[model samples]
Target: MKITSAVVSVVLLVSAQNSFGQFPAEEVSRFAIKDFTFESGQAFPTAVVAYATRGRLNAAKSNAVLLPSPYAADLHGYDAFIGPGRALDPQRHFLILTGMFANGQSSSPSNTPAPHGGPDFPRVTIRDNVRAAHELVTQQLGITKMTAVVGYSMGAQQAYQWAVSYPDMVESIAVICGNAKQYPFGVIRLEGSIAALKADSAWNNGRYTQPPVKGLRAFAIHYAAWSQSPVSWPRDMLDSMSNQQVDQFLRSLEAPALGMDANNVLSQAETWKRHNIGDSPGYNGDVEAALRAIKARVLLMPCRSDLYFPVADAEYEATFLQNGELAVIESSAGHAAGGGADSQAIRFIDGKLKGMLQ
Candidate 1:
């Protein structure tokens, strides 16, 4: 159950390497929409959505599997489950990996031009991301239907959104460590992280001349405490740390956050805070009704130790689904369990996904 520092380092290293396009991709492309409209009614000219694909579309174009990026991740977010013999074997299924709107790879506060850049960037919703990905699949890839939509964390939120928003388009969806709605407690956690990032003087109300190192560090510290289980801190960190080494360990945790753009972080956090399947058309904010409307088979995999998306929430949500299964990840890795951070958890997930896809 304990994830040692070495394991943490390897995970970070792999993520850093993947960010540079090291992961396998048959092709990497960007789909641009002219005058893209947000769910909030704000419009941005030439919003670009970045995506990557592996494998070839069969004659019917029916073997497509969509993998949406989680918060702060890119197209390669599902690299661990995609390979020759993996659950989502690229050779067997055409894998369409998408970047989240605010992850910098896609249209984001960091990459967008003025007027709609930085603090002025319009709020993005999980439904908005689904709409964009829908366009990419239908218009660009000519995919009429997807065999599955598999996701973890924020990506899982998108997966649930896809099932409800375009039920007929997705045959199945696997939601890992995410819920159909952003519960009040989850909103508070995200708000706290956002507040910490914006509190630094150098943040300058999102017009920072330089990176807000202090603010980012504070945000990272806050996130680190919640991202993993309380038991993990003692097993993986406190037990291994001496008084003299405490500061070094804390700095290591801050490194990743420091490299991220402040505005980009805020943009995704806002999107996460606003996610709700019921927000889709005709639901009237009725979460249970939305879940009942979904036609796709659902696999709900919530980590037992996940503080952000509790297992109890997933179990309750599963009851509403017309066709859903609840499978808890029994690991102390918390949310990371669903992100392929634990080898055993990854195997369990892959097996479940294989069954779902079958």
Candidate 2:
């Protein structure tokens, strides 16, 4: 799907400006912390983390729902399922938004230090990202415990990390569209995406001022294949996207004007690839053993047709979780729907969250 320049510009501008303008009903906020140190023993020369909150923290600060942003997604992704009468209603639970590392927003290469801003930012892993979130919830918000830490895709990986890293801090975890380990095939695909970016002459070894926009678009296209369901690309979605051919849908999702650095994407993808609860510091244990260590009740929400995180992945991971439940969002909407506000996902989230919090 070849997105016309006009539509690209519009989406980019809106996405750039508010990130959550489409969901005005929910309250959100943004913040930046200079030289944010990372768990990978490195620090971004400069970093910013965008966040949004709804409702209010109770006296004991236990009614909090920590939701991290998905890859290439902003906090708006959860709006439909988080309002009043919804699973994550701010009226009852304090919802906190955390931007994933290198999402081209909040502490990303696009907003990092001068000249080297784009891809030159330091590498940060899922573990590193969660630790920073822990700081925000504990030190900044003065919260000692949370009702839940929930997310989809990359955000889900962080949720898992939170459960393992601080089992005592989180009471429940809702993970949608993700798994415990990055399968070798998935790793290869991510590597190919970075390769597509680096192969472009514009990359200049991550030093290009205006890195290859075309290459970035191609990378986006490459990711689209992995992100969406194989057979569910809607005709309307295809029409809205500029790509003339169904094959080009992913390319249309790629926005070069966003100034998202290729190196940054590569680093973050690699960071996610390194995710593993068994690798926890001082935890020389089996994968199942580490997952079993998590005391938080778990909800594994997988899209029925997710191409990237297949249902089998979630099923295997669920078995390891100490107190876990498997909830499938039966939809042909694929992986994109996992990030979307689908009704089935909403119901699943609502039921699981309400039960866990209760």
Candidate 3:
């Protein structure tokens, strides 16, 4: 990946508090699907998906948006961009926040009953996740179609999968800092990171009920290196963060929470490693043909300095999709800027999301 100079001064502004009506989180009714086996072929009585929503559904229920959690990070990560006048304004559209399978809060190894609570939990794919989200909309919420689906990084991957798996169910998709398929380098690095955790004596063969904090911390440290641009990530930033008293914040990027089993990480990592639309086996045809098959309007947003999902990847997808456009944010924040809640990304999304609605 080529690195470019994208330095821009950031002037932080704290908006005055307003008594704007609040939109609190509400849980969606849950359901268990017995026959829904995972990609790993693990048999289970049910597959549980957890989700929270804000705002109201229109009479036509046509203004719904599904926002899936990014890898490891929960629904709270996108909180800053949602509100009355924000891109995901609850006043204008109903936003559903869905947790991914590996997230400990939902159906993951750590939370599964007894035998399934550790290394035994089934591995799930992006396809399986999208299907579950579809069920959430159709069965749980009674939403037939969504006006748009938007997210960043892993969440953006889910957004893409949603449009691909159920073209008729989505009108448009806004993907930021993500790719249709995990790059070869990304796959290798993720595998190595997972292996590093398992290799630690603290892991104890994935049987430790409390979790291997040391191993998790190591993994997080390794990931911190990959999560941003080397040129832009100054030592001062790391030093400043290290000075903080909160070890949890330091390790938040590194380790999973207590009782959050490592197997879940391995499972999700494997699914990501195999993440290729062409992996459907024998669907090995033209890449553009597969992209052109999508019926939804597409917006691809990439930060100019992003390390993981490069601008070229988003640009390539936009060229293939029937109604897609690339909107690159010119900032030095790298992959972090894409999800870091920067002004440029926010401004681009605000305009594009509204345009898609019109």
TM of each candidate vs. truth = 0.94, 0.83, 0.84
Off by over 4 Å in 1: 1-27
List the pairs of residues colliding in candidate 3.
220-254
Model 2 residue 126 CA deviation (Å) reads: 0.7
Pitting candidate 1 against candidate 3, the one with the higher TM-score is 1
Better of 1 and 3 by lDDT: 1
> Residue-wise lDDT of candidate 3 within 2-105, one digit each (tens)?
11222221111000000011123244434566667765676777787777788999999988988887766555646657888777888988999877787655
Candidate 1: count the clashes.
0
**Ten-residue segment with the worst summed lDDT in candidate 1?**
13-22
Candidate 3: segments with Cα more than 4 A from true spot: 1-29, 235-260, 280-282, 285-287
Query: Where does candidate 2 stray beyond 4 Å?
Result: 1-36, 43-47, 114-116, 234-251, 255-259
Evaluated at residue 267, the lDDT of candidate 3 is 65
lDDT of 1 at 175: 97
lDDT of 3: 0.69
lDDT of 2 by residue, 130-224 (tens): 87788778877898898898888888888888999998999888888887667777787777887876788988877786768878777766765
Which whole-number lDDT from 0 to 100 does residue 291 have in model 2?
Answer: 82
Top candidate (TM-score): 1
